[model samples]
Target: MTHFRNDMENHDFFDTNIVCSIVIYEWANELSIIDFKHIFDWISQLVGTAPDSIQLAESEAKYKSYKWKYFEKNNVINRREWDLIAYHWFRNIETKSGIRVYCVASTRSFRRLGIYIDEAAVVDVIGVMKQISRTIIEKVEPIYGYGAMQSYLDGPLEYARGINVTTYYSHENIFSQADVDTRERISAFGSEFRKNKRRLNEKLRDVEVINYISAGHLAGIVDGMTLEDWIISGNRGTLNKEGEATWVWRIPDEHERSQIRTDLIRSGLLVVTI
Candidate 1:
């Protein structure tokens, strides 16, 4: 067997998800918890049998355990280190062509989670693989309710156009109409008010200044705008439009480009030539 000492020293760590995907793709037939344990145990045994490999694995494992324990105590593990170790382990296995062993274990659940391997560790790997385990879960859980709020808005918007024609459309006059005509007028006015409010909000929302710079000018503008927005506005050079060179703004009608230019000039980020 290829030795762990030689392999570990040379490998570059990769993301756990990639390793899991590779294993699943390659060993869809016989992957299991038991199989995973067998492979790890076999590797561990090789470490034991080879003095150099054993020393390396022990040294690496000691350092890893110390780092893990430190992070665990201080809560830094959730922020960064765990993923790094899993990444290292995954890279070490795949770099040495040991992916077939993981592939075999991925097919068998029992073998995959068996004794020599901790199911919690595999759970950790699964969590890392999905990019949605402890670290993400902790960060996302607090914001989970926002998703429901979004769904509530999105659900209405999905059928908003057809809502008036639907039977479920609740009009005040439809239920109680002692003064049918007056109620109809009031309801129409209320609907108009709501529609106008929505439109006004949308218009207000649409008004935002967008700035752009070419790749060559990126370093100068990085602090002023997002990388994504910069990329969306393609690279272009400013030409001397008249006696002076001018940068053009390309925002849709809602935004006032002159105001943006004034602000940029006032901030001294942009210079206007006479």
Candidate 2:
């Protein structure tokens, strides 16, 4: 692992231990159409909310229907108005006493950018996409750290695992396990397989080679291989025909360029450049 100095300025960070609720509102809008009933049913099962017990106020229902029709007629809504409403709702719940609430949704409608939801609530307004056939409650569980009280509306929101660069790899591991099981359990869950494959490919692309050695040895082996001032300048034929220079990367000849390249391949690192 590579370590870097901390260069962050002091700032107020949110409490990571607090219990938070997440609400994913799929409200009908001018941009995208979704199946409200299906989403409601899926969330209900996840949250342990009785399907029949969830209340849909009459006025809210009417407004939803009107907005649905309006969206159908017009391609999109007034962006400013929609943003204002979303902001107001988030502010209303975020400042509530005793508990922290987070608004998370895939849709860009929500104004809280890059804020991970402590809880997700799918409002009755947003309809579900038609292509979705099954709900994967387990996938959502690990996203919020496992053992969170899973619920649709009004369920106790459990804190999700803090998402950092290191945890990103962990998340991929969990997702890979889920994909393997999903392929065995459901015949049509090929989507999960494709998604995992794509992620694996992306991770392979980020692999890099780091060379650490004594400043003196690196200078003797190759120019510009060590710290700037420590580098030796001379006609050293350290580069290959492709103009790719070789650096003394602290590995013995047995683990040098050719051998290391092979090792990296086995370790799932695609060497795009020497």
Candidate 3:
């Protein structure tokens, strides 16, 4: 069985030409939410422009709260510090160089900062990851961290023709305490996966791996992989002073992608039910 997303043509579908990088973090509850200014500012500098639109989530409580709406950039940026009490901020900022950047900041349990750029900008996703290590990980010391380049629409066709590159980053032992914490979480996830009665083969049925292959030619980078194999791949990982550790491969196409999706689901890092 294979899976396919029928809504790929929807408005919210990722733009094929857009390149995105995502940083995953265990929420920093101890840090002040106000630090969002510094984070967004860093993103603005990277894109070389102020944000055009902003969305905020101030109250955790759903009652009497409507802060998820998009607010004018000027209205939010021009306000005083005391007024910027939102727990989450999302921005859409673009540059004249034909680069589009989208940044999201949050102080919630699982914090993720996503950076989306136009392929034309040719921004270094790893550079962005290194900056995140210095500015966020060093100070906040998150329990676990991972960064990866995402697959966009038309990924199979684009990569089959040598259009884009796919990258993965998983950290181990960057900080003593955080390393231990991340290991424990991964272990627990592994245990949970084994306990599930659903067969691993069956789980693969829900997601389609879009690929293009010709006679005697396979354009996929990953041949065959299991859940544990993917989890243990992080053990050999190491980060530099700037906290850089990445695994890069070209032509991930649909086969490798399907394996990745399966790994993420089995590890509980992502969720989808058929």
Candidate 4:
């Protein structure tokens, strides 16, 4: 399979592929506790209500709801330092014409922000938030001192994703086109990535393929064996053994098995082979 390969010269074969992406960020703006308080107060004042009191009003023809709350839990802001949050709210605005702007404060970086355009919206939420955050930061940046504004997809490391916006600093999708067979194999592997590892002692006399999921867990068979030997042997067979497993991954050869195993091991998503 494409994911598994043999290096002829090295006479080696490895299974699977794991990909990781990370971005780091530095301080862009600064804000003190008092400044954050003021910002929250300003936003609440603009809407003519207290943070918790913000909600849709029947009087306004347009649908609207603005809410916020403060928490003193341990959190990483700006630089990996723990600090309390002053203002936080997930906001969605839609015009009568169907234009929408969705925005949320960066939970990672207390002072950072994020905006993603809704699929149906005509206007870019990023463009709108950029202008609004710029003004807010301009007024608060010098006063409060916070990290720079970095845009990131919805996930962890939004702060790291914010470190810089240049192509070099931004997240890049490295996925490439795979042939039909390769695509199918990858699809199968990904779908079952969280399944427990299957036991095929026949392929690995001493070692047993294992499952991995999130953060850690990937050592390839109980005992380390030469890639060549592992390839020559395999773990696939006719459906003979059965119990609670809903399904099993019918590995073709140890070479391909090792590749898939390697990929799963690297990404930390191997489930018991099933």
- Please name the candidate that would achieve the greatest TM-score relative to the true structure: 3
- Point out where model 3 deviates above 4 Å: 1-14, 27-29, 59-99, 109-111, 121-129, 154-274
Query: Candidate 3, after superposition: displacement of residue 217 in Å?
Result: 38
TM-score of each: 0.16, 0.21, 0.41, 0.24
Q: List clash counts for every candidate, in order.
A: 19, 21, 2, 27
lDDT of each: 0.24, 0.24, 0.36, 0.28
Best by lDDT: 3
Sort the candidates on lDDT, descending order. 3, 4, 1, 2
How does candidate 3 fare on TM-score? Answer: 0.41
**lDDT string, candidate 2, 173-274, tens digits:** 331122332223222212332233322212121111222122222233212232223222322213211101212222223334345444344543321222
Model 3 lDDT tens row, 1-274: 1111222222333334445443333333355545665666665555444554444544323212122233332345334322222222121212212124445544542233434543333245545545644565444543333333434442322221112323322132121122343334334434433354323221221222211111111111222544234324643222222322212122225565555555555544331321
Error of 4 at 246 (Å): 56
**lDDT (Cα, tens digit) per residue for candidate 4, span 218-239:** 1233335432223334443221
lDDT per residue as tens, model 1, 185-247 = 334433543354322211111112222222222223433563224434533212111111112
For candidate 3, the lDDT comes to 0.36
Worst lDDT window (10 residues) for model 3? Answer: 210-219
Local distance difference test, candidate 4: 0.28
Candidate 2 vs. true structure, TM-score: 0.21
- Itemize residue pairs with steric clashes in candidate 3: 3-207, 3-208
**Model 4 regions more than 4 Å off:** 1-30, 43-82, 90-127, 140-274
